[model samples]
Target: MKTKSTTLLLTAITGSLILLLGSGCGKKTVMPPETTMDGGADAGTPISYPAAEGGGYSEESLPIEGSLDDTSTATSVTAAEGMAEPTEEYKKLYGRSTRGLSPIYFNFDQATIRPDMVAKMESNSEYIRQIPNAYVVIEGNTDDRGTNEYNIALAERRAQNTKQYLVDLGTDPARVRTVSYGEEKPLFFGQDEISYSQNRRADFIIE
Candidate 1:
């Protein structure tokens, strides 16, 4: 009986030790993979890699250094001071008018027609009606304050708005073309709001 008790005690101790060891085993935590300077994958570094050919990774891929496809060096463009930029292709399409309205100025950043300009536009419409096949190019402009491209769009809108007003007043839609010069053109050169307001105008070119 004593020998049997000794064997049972030994077995119990071994079983308890195994239970403790099993409970002590911990879980492993995984971390994100890293990126290398050569746009390659690293086990611990984080970075972005450019798309490879056929949309897969290759260690031999070359890294892009600076401005890609830079063409400023090929065609050197130097703008003249206090001068309006060259007219766009669309503006070039319709040159100076043989007969049309005089240059009409607008309030700053306004595309709406003033009460006083109504008579002038009415008279202009009559002149356009007199000549069949007479087309007019409306040029929109703004002061030099905003982005060049944005001003171009704004100027274009001003021209288009003026053209639409004329169309509503019986001018032929087919005879009208529009261009936005944006902030590129100004009769008076300055940074003041008054100069800007003066530049925000529409001019007509009859053809």
Candidate 2:
């Protein structure tokens, strides 16, 4: 019986030790995996952002470095100081009456010739240069946005600038005249961007 009791005590102690170990008597320490510079990625594995042609990393959103294009260069051009305003006599005559020629367009509230309209100006100037003593009456029109007087002034500038550009392209300055129709003669009547844009222009008339 004494031997049996000792055997039972040894079995109990063994069971208690097993239970203690299984119940996590001591906490286990876990070491994190090693990481390198590629944002916590392993040294052997490299992660790339903003893929290039060969599936590699590239510089972020770099701008192109160069001179401006023809259109950009044209837009950058400013109206000359002499062509900035009109005199009282030119306004009074209304450029008189004349026959129709090719029309050139302008941007909203701007007297500067757009790049697209540059070709038209060149062709029109060629025609003026070819004709014998041909006179050009530039009639400027504007969109129905500002006041009548303001629109008149804006339209005047448009005509004057167009005339100045034509003169620069070899047309005689004396042969060219300018008139501001303002919002009076709108080709398009609709209240939209398309209509408004269409109205902002300078039409050439030969006298």
Candidate 3:
């Protein structure tokens, strides 16, 4: 009976030792957390990705300033292009004489023929009558107070008024033509009142 009891105790101790060894072998070894390569962040902390290669723009790649000024310059060029071009007949009669009839002057921004210039128109009409099959171009001009476009329109009104007056004085309507010089062909260059008044005149060109 004593021997059997001793054998049972040894068998139980051997079985417990085997179970502990097997459990130790089955467990996995634990490793430490990895850090960023730059070592800037702590372990288990998130690191932002680097900026995309060549993705951002520099100052040199941006659009230029003063775009409004560029637009203004382009508009000025377009306005200049809109001005009237001279005709071949106008080029031929540009510097020709108008006999004794002088250039008729106007008041500031006025297209109406003054009473003083009535005689001049009559004389011009008589001179036209003297010459058979002669045509005359009345060139209207203005002072440099307004824009090219406004001055051109004003000049046209002046020329039309003068041409009508000549036609009323017995001159043939078909023999008369009109053009506007605007402020381009100034009779006097000074900015004073007298110069401006002289420049605001209608010139005669015989063709």
lDDT of 2 by residue, 42-64 (tens): 55654324566776445532222
Top model by TM-score, which number? Answer: 3
TM-score for each predicted model, relative to the true structure: 0.49, 0.52, 0.53
Evaluated against the true structure, the overall lDDT of model 3 is 0.74
Q: lDDT of model 3 at residue 44? A: 61
The CA lDDT of each predicted structure is: 0.68, 0.73, 0.74
Comparing 2 and 3 on TM-score, the stronger one:
3
The count of backbone overlaps in candidate 3 is 0
Cα RMSD to the true fold for all candidates: 15.4, 16.6, 22.1
Ranking the candidates on TM-score from highest down gives 3, 2, 1
1-98 per-residue lDDT for model 3 (tens digits):
99999999999999999999888866597864555656654656644444444875454444433332242221221232343333323322332236
- State residue 105's C-alpha deviation in candidate 3, in Å: 0.7
Candidate 1 lDDT, 90-162, residue by residue in tens = 2222222233455566776677888887887788788888877767888888878778987787788788888
Which scores greater on TM-score, model 1 or model 3? Answer: 3
User: What does the lDDT read for residue 184 in candidate 1?
Assistant: 66
TM-score (C-alpha, index-matched) for candidate 1:
0.49
Error of 3 at 17 (Å): 99
Q: Model 2, which residues run further than 4 Å from truth?
A: 1-100
